[model samples]
Target chain A: MANVLVNAPKTAKRGSIVEIKALILHPMETGFRPGPNGRIIPRNIIERFTATWNGTEIFDMEMSPAIAANPFVSFFAVASESGTVGLRWTGDEGFVVEERVAIAVE
Target chain B: MIARHFGIGLAIVFIASYALAQGMADKGGTDKRRSGTQDMGGVLQKMQDDDTANPGMLFVQLGGELWGKASGASGKSCADCHGSVASMKGVAARYPAIPKGADAPVDLEGRIDLCRTANQRAGSLTSESRELLALTAYVAHQSRGFPITPPDDPRLAPFRARGEKLWQARQGQLNLSCAICHDDNAGKKLAGVTIPEAHPTGYPIYRLEWQTLGSLKRRLRNCLAGIRAEPYAYDAPEYVMLDLFLMDRARGMMLESPGVRP
Candidate 1:
């Protein structure tokens, strides 16, 4: 398992903002880099990330090659009626990494 | 509601960006790029800082599993003989060291093969091997945060002396010595990139350039090639000698094995 670490308050007041932090393991390889033989290494990077609250999309964005390896992304969503907050990163060759954490609203 | 949500998300983005920049500046030192870990480009730094995000952790995790697996004619698992892996702290830092009765020093990789053949009766794995790298990284990971200490034994004198000479010796058509850049001009700009002091604080590091974990020899070979010189063979003694010298020279620096480098 490419370890994914995420932090979200276990309990939150309804309608309050809940911050989420996520870091995923990845090379985010850019094709512009040259190999030891001086050959250009093919680009391979996470192209998109989406965050959802119980199937309802809260935030999503397109990621480019410049984001760096092992991308660390943070975003906050209103703790409306929480179920599961999920983050998904889709990359080259249809690679997808997803993590989900549940939050309870008081 | 949607607009407010977007506003919070935007603020988070701004915070993340600020943290990213601040992380580099947070490293307090005259030279921020002293270790290989600090030399990483922006993205690579994030990869190395959080273990959850580093791809090299995959190998380290596998190595943890392999540590206790029995193999070869001896049917012995490494753990059976070595006991708790946690006890191995600070051992990797002392390697490329001379084993008892041996005239030459053996780096971690070499020692792995020695254990396999001599103790386990297992066949040797090839250089830059998946299993070998994983095991080496796993073993070395235990020593993370320990200082690299060159043993003061008199027997190691000649090899260290040879290594010292090689560091300053000019080579290749470019006729460049390792000192010219790594020592003399370290921290200065060269070809739009700041020259690093060439510390070996990390080894079996994951270089974004190669996109894989490589031993110190590979990095040395790269330097040789950069100088337009013929690189040594993978297992050459000269490489080992140079590695010994480099490790000793960088003694007392923190070990950051399985590091990420740009």
Candidate 2:
């Protein structure tokens, strides 16, 4: 699986447009069908997702199994200060993945 | 001859690169069967046999019961009005149908409204309500094993084509098309979650997380919101068209409505 990619401003002045693009590696199974061997695949799906900028979460999500696998999300943030933008994904197995990129304000 | 050779070489390279990217995109990481608690074989077997614990079956049962109950001015149950569901089986698999005098094929939601006005004498169910979802799921379940085959009447052709276009059209600030995430990049993890193939065979499903049932339109609305696109109304033609398109793509997948999802 590809690592979650977080593309955003590494540094920016306060109040500037901060672009955020995040993609994770997941198989977001809908859990409706069976596998080749013909078994009712138990539901294992990512339930929640969150993204925070310097500990202040900007985006939060309540995801259902309906979302397609390996979801990609992109949004904007007004840079208020220089800090690390952290992203996290919580799934059935546990906290399945996380990634971070530092943002600097001029 | 030199130009022909160059063209062939270019074509081969394009084909090879496309194949390689597809393989990388399709590697093991995206198998929902593997990710779930149950093993792949177990899931398939459970699907083949009717298992009570199967969350999907529970929803199916609920839908069946709802199909028989009556509540409206006409004082007619769905069974009383439409006759046995057996006659209506496989009917849902062919919706959003374009009627002779209508602009487009009425979607499942629209058909439900038609039933309400003509027989039940009640207002249409709200687009996102549980009652509507349950009924849609129960009705669609009748065609559980059938493949999705949209009606091929001439009036439907353009709408079907439009739906195909929507599936491939890129939108939102992310500049992503449904195909980019669902087709080209399926199975890749985004934010630690695997991206399953986008399929609509099992809808009006019971989501364990929501602890309730929902329809495909609600899910589509959510996706549009996630991507920052302007979402259409629940029963909007655009959504109806998209649903048809997706069902066609998901042809051959078994229906498993009222499915349980995490």
Candidate 1: list runs displaced more than 4 Å.
Answer: A1-106, B1-47, B53-55, B71-75
| Candidate 1 structure, TM-score to reference | 0.72
lDDT of 2 by residue, B69-177 (tens): 8878988888986777788788777887875456767788678767877679877788856567657766877876565676767776677779889879988887777
Residue B215 in candidate 1 has what lDDT? 80
What fraction of the correct interface contacts does each predicted structure contain?
A: 0.20, 0.00
**Best candidate (score: TM-score):** 1
Cα lDDT tens digits for candidate 1, B1-262: 9999999999999999977755544364542546755655877777677675565676687678778888799999899999888977888898888887788988888988889888999889788887788788899999887778878878877887898899999999999999999999987888988788888877888776776677887889999999999998877888878878888888777787878777
> Of the candidates shown, which would achieve the greatest DockQ relative to the real structure?
1
Q: For candidate 2, what is the lDDT?
A: 0.69
Using all chains and alpha carbons, the TM-scores for the candidates as numbered come to: 0.72, 0.56
**Where is the poorest 10-residue window by lDDT in model 1 chain B?**
B24-33
In terms of docking quality, model 2 is incorrect
lDDT scores for all predictions? 0.82, 0.69
- What is candidate 1's lDDT per residue for A1-106, written digit by digit as tens? 4546676788899999888878666778878989999999889899999999999999898989887776768789999885999889888977888889999988
lDDT of 2 at B206: 48
Candidate 1: fnat, from 0 to 1?
Answer: 0.20
